[model samples]
Target: MIMDIIKQGGRARTTGRPRDACPYPADSRERRAWFEGYDGSAWELSTRVPHPSVALRGVSACPDAATVSNQAAAAT
Candidate 1:
């Protein structure tokens, strides 16, 4: 979605992450989107904001039912 592109790009720019460090596959539209925000003001933002990462994102998608059950069983 457009919002996702904006978000990733913004993060890339703010974090001063290299263009090659895009999480999306090579030659993909998402990578292009990421590059959008990663222009011009990268170092400025990077000085004020941390780089992007899953841990820094703070939230995560839920696992599937089977995976959850497996984890629960393993715990018990």
Candidate 2:
């Protein structure tokens, strides 16, 4: 398997080995500036992309059960 080189500080996913080669999220809200793992892990294997701002906005706009449930599901 190909190794994923994650930034120790910033949360960007890059294809190349160079640290600065990752493409950042275009949306300001989705953009992350830092990431941390205690055990000196190289990468976080994930299948989903983060959409925190959307989830936050959704929850804020409608704190109802249905929207919150949907957001929770999406996050997972």
Candidate 3:
């Protein structure tokens, strides 16, 4: 976990503020990607992509079956 945070350029000193809870996603989605960015004060969702090239970090969980089912149903 520490390694992952470091790889994400988690600079403690620059951050100034103490680290809060890690918002690691508990689910993974196929052909979908989520990103975060800091906007001066705090982190926020940056963007979403249908397919992302980079290997996403802090995503330790796989998407649940029900989520995929619902997405597919909605698409149809």
TM-score of 2: 0.19
lDDT (tens digit, per residue) of candidate 2 on 1-76: 0123223323332222344433445433212322221122323444333345445554453458777899999999
lDDT against the true structure, each candidate: 0.61, 0.38, 0.36
- Across 23-46, the per-residue lDDT of candidate 3 in tens digits comes to 444443210111122112222234
How high a TM-score does candidate 1 get? 0.40
Which runs in model 3 stand beyond 4 Å of their true positions?
Answer: 1-63
Give the per-residue lDDT digits (tens) of candidate 1, residues 1-76.
9457757777766677776776878777666666655542233344433334543685333448668889999999
Superposition error at 62 for model 1 (Å): 50
Q: Pick the candidate with the highest TM-score.
A: 1
RMSD of each: 13.0, 13.0, 14.1
List where candidate 2 sits over 4 angstroms from the true fold: 1-5, 8-46, 59-76
